[model samples]
Target: MLLNMNFIVKALLGLCLVNSAFSARILFVMIAPSLSHHIFFRHLIKELSFRGHDVVSISPDPMNDPKLTNITEIDIHTETYDAFDARKWLETVQYNKPSSEISLMRSFLPLFYTQADNVLSAPKVQELIQNKNEHFDLVIVEMLMFNAHLFALRERFNCPAIGLASLDTSLNAMDAIGNPTDPNYYGSFFTEFSGGNLSFWERLQLLWHHIDFRLYYYLEYLPISDAMIAKHFNITDKTAWDLEKSVDLILTNTNPIFHIPRPKVPNYIDIGGMHMRERKPLPKDLKQFLDDSKQGVIYFSLGSNVKSTNLPAEKRAAILNVFRQLPYNILWKWENDTLPDKPANVLIKSWLPQQDVLDHPNLKAFITQGGIQSMEEAIRSNVPLICMPFGGDQKFNARRIADLGIGRRLPFDDITADTFLDAITDVASNPKYKKSITKLASVLWDQPTKPLDRAVWWVEYVIRHGGAKHLRSPAADFPWYKYLMLDIIGFILAVVIIALIVIIKVIKLLFRIIPLKKIKLKEQ
Candidate 1:
């Protein structure tokens, strides 16, 4: 019996060894120049490297982790800042809005394509690709914007590819993996409607959103991205369209806690809150500030992309006036070195440990820019929010917070003392906001395992199973008409038409042969 037990143990140990032997070499071509995007991809690489996978990460920001042994950080220089200016973006998006739908679509394409062009044009990226001996098992591309350009990397390596989206689940991204975009219920990227029955107008807006986005992609976005990738890579065998279509799996930064109800296939994984980490002790001054506050502390941040310092002087004064009047001590993330008038209650820091601040015991409410990452941290900390969104999916995210009954949206244009006071007071003082936020926090936290663990497991699963092709739906391969069953509908309609035509011909022939006069006499 002892010998039998030993045998079993030995067999299990050997099996473990066999599984551990399959250490993969992964290439993370993360060229997103945003800090939030960089942080998420950096977390992923760290997790993968911790599990003994050799990782080559091409990113603007590098985590020079002495602890992580299996990772190579290739520092990349992208002209994202040179190409796109956030302060300018804020000015245009807020003050001078696009005139038409075409103008809106045209306005946004450059922000993404500029990053694409710059990343591909980077010296290190070109070097990494041109190297003949450097091989990888899989390539993970940060695909928030243009996916087709990065798909060229997969073509070069002849390996499986996976996409990572920094934003919420995108319909175009889902389309790449063959998931259905049921626009009937699925909110548009900016509408940010939570799960509820939509009004007729809302449904029409969704339908129009679907139509407009698809039209924009095909007519304006697709051609530009395709030409860029082809010209840069000298792509010969397949079109840029095929390159994007060949992607195996896409990981979205959306959880059921935050996202509306949408059907996703196996290939589409939700690894939301992967960037979340254990909170560290706050700085001494910050801790003291929070602890000493008679009321609670309000944490305000505009996230990484948009700097709070860029706010016009008048706007700053308006917000400051409100903060001065409030009982709460406000920790504002100000980007500049110095300011003229200092409010006594407001502490202006060029940078902040945002999650730690939100986790404080004296936290009454969060005043935020409605970035998804900040919203996730607030939820995790069970802090209610007063959102002021700028652009992109921030509008949707803010609306979602309001829809969940956990927060209120205050427009930047209307940031007067009274409006700010009302919004902040409502979110902070209300029991319902706390209750709703806490409930969702509990739900979001109650996972089978850590989100990071799930993400790593799926990443390994893809590598182990050779690209998750079985998980890929046939809908991905289908043309638009076939996927929507328009062809099938057309065929059915054609058969019905043919049947009607034959029946009409038979009636006419009978009327010609059989005398109508005799039929009339018989009736008489």
Candidate 2:
């Protein structure tokens, strides 16, 4: 019996090994110039390589890890940044206004075209495309403002492709995937209004914004992208819009904890915090600072794109004045080497391990620019927030954070020492903020599978099945009129109008006949 059991165990082990050996060849393209964006996607790329799949990654930031044997990194860092200067663009942001969310779709149209053309025209990419031997089982491209990368799906690789976003799904992406964009219920990511509890006027504004943006995207933006993509790929057959619609799946960095809950097609998956991992040990000075802070620490950062050094001198002084009076020790992610009149209770660093710092036991609250990734880190660490939004979905994130009772939102441009002090002290001392975030963290983590695992599984599922076409919503292929059933409504209205006309004519004819009959009777 013992001999038979040993043989059975060996057979089971062999079967498990065989199942784990399944791997796919994937083409991953992420050309966005922002490091925060790349940081979120890097987790998936490394995870796939570790699982033994062969991955060719074209990205601004490559893993460059010698141990990632299965990954072939093609660096496009210089090409992308040269086309779009992120820091210069950020410096131009208007911070003094109540609404910082500008019309990026309109303002950045030329930059998008430039970026797409530059990446596609790069020599490395050209060689990869020209090489006839190059093939892939699946293709994954960043689905942000640029669509030129999608050309690889049909023009080059001729395989299944997936769209990935480092932020919440934008209006353009929602339309591409045939996901429902109910203006009344679901506001666009760029909009300041959160989904629920909108007044009538707000709803109308949301509706108008939705229609105006969609029309601009289809009529104006898409044509430019299509032209650039066509020119680079040397393709005459299909437009860039066609390739975007053909994407088998979209993996977005969004979650219901902070995002508005809405209906989604099977192909769109939320893997928001996939980049989050086990916290690492903080550097010696940083660890000592946090540990020694008897009153607790407040972490502040404006994310990768926005720099604190770019703040107006007056605004900087106002912020410092508030920090000087606060009892809490402050750790600010300052970009510059020096902060004039640096407070005794404050520590400034050009860079910090954000996640590790947030997880510290001495952390009281986080004062942030309210980027989605920063919010996710704060929530995962069960830390409350004081959100001072700078730009680009930060306003919306701040609103949601306040609505959820996990934090407070303050205007960055209109900051005063008194208001800033109030926000800091309220969030740091309030028990409700801690309780709300703790409860939310529990809900956010109560998933059947870890987000990264789910993302990898879906990527492999596409390879295994040769595409997730079966999961694609029919709404994606439907024209605007057909999807909204407007054609059917119009047909019904036409039939009703014709029937009313015929009935009125019949009544008039009967009246004439009855009057003629009465006249004949009188003559007789």
Candidate 3:
């Protein structure tokens, strides 16, 4: 009896130890206050918490609702930018050309540097790091904008970190891990599609743009980042600043069907449709609106950054006039209550449940500014789109969707009631658009598991496997010259030059010897 009790106690202790070892605490950092980014991170946090992981999020504000109980919120106020005023910057960009934009970005680098500095220098960030009593097993960081925060956390925690790219994980993070972005892939930020096929001068401009990016990141961004990390962690021997070195895994919120094939590192996981999970319930009014709309519904949203209310009066009037004439009920995600005129068929609200509205069976078409999250939701729900891309990556995303035959792009400046009506009419009346969307939806869903599930499972898998060291890409350690294949090409060119030189010398020597021998024979 005594022996059995002792054995049971020992077994219980071992089990407890095992359980403790397997448990993980993950910290998520997000900088953007945009709704799309927030929603993506919110779903990920919820999924992680559901899997019994301790998840903490650091962002400008706690965007997640109160329902997400398990996730702790750390509020860090980074520099705020008016997304509306960006239109002025963009107008300047267009007028001055790409080189001017590069120069503008170079000028703007100091602002981002200052923002990163402030966030890192905050008392809360410092307190979090110094509080040795608090412990974390892993760090998940949103890899948009500045990477300074990520580096700071990695150096401070010295734990395995993962990157969560809210947009398609093609260029920025994937490039860091040796995955070359395919120029043919239209949606990739690095592709010719991003800047359009350029002439020699334009190409030079693009090159300058890239160089500008590198310079800004290395000179302004990296030093501030490294300084923060060193100050907090007390590490003096910092060498290179490779973001891939700081992260153990990268989970992209992009679907494979939408992206071109590229070599994926072991640690890189594509979890594109992670935001398509079903919510518990729709608001009663929204539900009734969907049910009441016998003629089907058209959803119009400019995403988080570009507000419809903020549009110039002419543009706003054009859209309003178009919406009034449309036969279908319009659910406009308007940020303001007062508009010039409200049509009987139009429902204007400060905000709407975007995913929920998209999921409604009556939702026939989406008129959008071509945000990736909105596009993903429309694709997932088999709804066609009329893309009016304003700026930034929206143009690329709009073009890709249009190329897929599931959508059409209309420039915001060129928008008129007739054009808007015609575009919306075509998307609604045409069976081809619905067919294409449905086909893509089938492809998106054909996977063994849902995207959100895969994301959740993999995040937990990282935790269970003791920080997923196997997923770290070896290319992260390679020198830039080697990673870019410049060194290999240089070596090959050098060898060819040396061989040509040797051959030329040998030929000259033979010619000289033969002439001398001929002379000697003639003399004899």
Candidate 4:
């Protein structure tokens, strides 16, 4: 009997070793604590596991899912930054003017620097790098993750890395590759939308911001990141580590159909619809409510960070008043219990299965803060939107959706019951909005394979190909000025100025000589 037990234990141990050997290991690093940002990568991770990849995620907390059998969680806690709590900060700036609000937000940029610094300095990260046996073939890191981690892993593990950005891929990541962001838009390299359509003042603002970003990167983020990498990895050769050497591919969560035309680098892949795939069963009660409601459901969520309950009293009252009148059954993602006045049409819950709700046939419209992930889901579900954008890129995303003719934008402060009613009524009654969203949905979902499959395939491709070296951008060797076309512009400007001065001098000399010759001839 003792021998039988011993034999069973040995067999089990052997099976475990064999399973570990065959499993393809992947390391995914994300810096987002907010649910919105984390949601963007959830499907991608699941898909990797589905494809038989052993996925390890470095995140602030473990994912709530029980079926994520292959996923291992690594804690990466970030320092609490004031800017991250935008809702609380906005309350402090309530009395301030719009310009003041914008200025204050800019001033708080240091918070991100501090947060990044704290994340990069975490001892766990250093320990992970030191564990020589736990090497990853490919490292998929969020853009907000310390850039130093990318550098250190490439130098230490000698593995290829890819960037996953929740926002539209900007110049910061694209410039690492050969692609350049457009300057006319906020993320654009040449454009500034001070108030839309480049004016002289707008041009100056754009130029100033461009210079500011470059300076901030060099003076603050780069130096701090470099120091962290050096300290963690004990590397002195700074020149050897470049963004290009570290990042082989960039996967942006932005659809090309929504963005303006721009040159795409070979290494940059726009896998926007990766997060929009169908989810499993919704909660029974929620699913039943949606099915029972003869009228379409109006889904309201302020996203993960900013709670609707935290809104100012007047704003909350205004929202409640609007909700009271809406005929549609409301699924409000209210984090707090006991709203002052509850409407019969409204069903308030601390949380809702957002994607599942969106996927439901009864969901008529999404009333949102226009977070990109939410917007993408709404688009995927062919649901029109009433976007009351709060802050940051929400405004930009709202405008984008409105521009696409699938939604309407209502400022949070200015939203009234009438406006809300009108917007919802218009979206529900008008077939065009639904038609447009349906069109976008088709475009977003028309890929040859599932987005998850594609994402997982590429991840494995990078691992199998030993870091996709063929896709690495050659431009990583260039300086910032060279990458931005500033160097070329500066040279051209200098040459033009010199030529103008030379021409002026020649004109003056010719005039003086001609007059002198005329006088001499007349006297003779």
Best candidate, TM-score-wise? 2
lDDT value, residue 307 of candidate 2? 84
Q: Where's the lowest-lDDT run of ten residues in candidate 1?
A: 187-196
lDDT by residue (1-524, candidate 3, tens digit) is: 99999999999999888766666788887765455677777888877776667788877757557877778887764443332134444444433444443366565666655656566566776688788777787778877535644655665666767788877653446556655543332334432243344366655545554555566656665676566556656655762265435666788876667654456777788887787766557899989998999999998888776777777777778788887788899998888876668888888888887888888999989999887788888887899999987655676677778778998888766788788889999999899999999998888778888778887777777766657767666777677688778999999999999999999999999999999999999999
Give all candidate RMSDs, comma-separated: 3.5, 2.6, 4.5, 6.0
- lDDT for each of the candidates? 0.81, 0.85, 0.71, 0.71
> For model 2, what is the alpha-carbon lDDT of residue 55?
89
* Ten residues in sequence with the least summed lDDT for candidate 4: 187-196
**Cα distance off (Å), candidate 2, residue 330:** 0.5
Using all chains and alpha carbons, the TM-scores for the candidates as numbered come to 0.92, 0.94, 0.86, 0.83
Candidate 1's residue-wise lDDT over 413-448, tens digit each?
Answer: 888878888998888898999999999999888999
Measured by C-alpha RMSD in angstroms, how accurate is candidate 4? 6.0
Highest lDDT model number: 2
Worst 10 residues of 3 by lDDT: 183-192
- The residue-by-residue lDDT of candidate 4 on 457-488, one tens digit each, is 67777877777668766676577678668989
TM-score of 2: 0.94
Q: Which portions of model 1 miss their true places by more than 4 Å?
A: 1-20, 65-67, 85-91, 99-102, 108-114, 505-515, 519-524
For every model shown, the clashing-pair count is 0, 0, 1, 8
Q: Is candidate 1 or candidate 3 better by TM-score?
A: 1
Candidate 1 vs candidate 2: the TM-score winner is 2
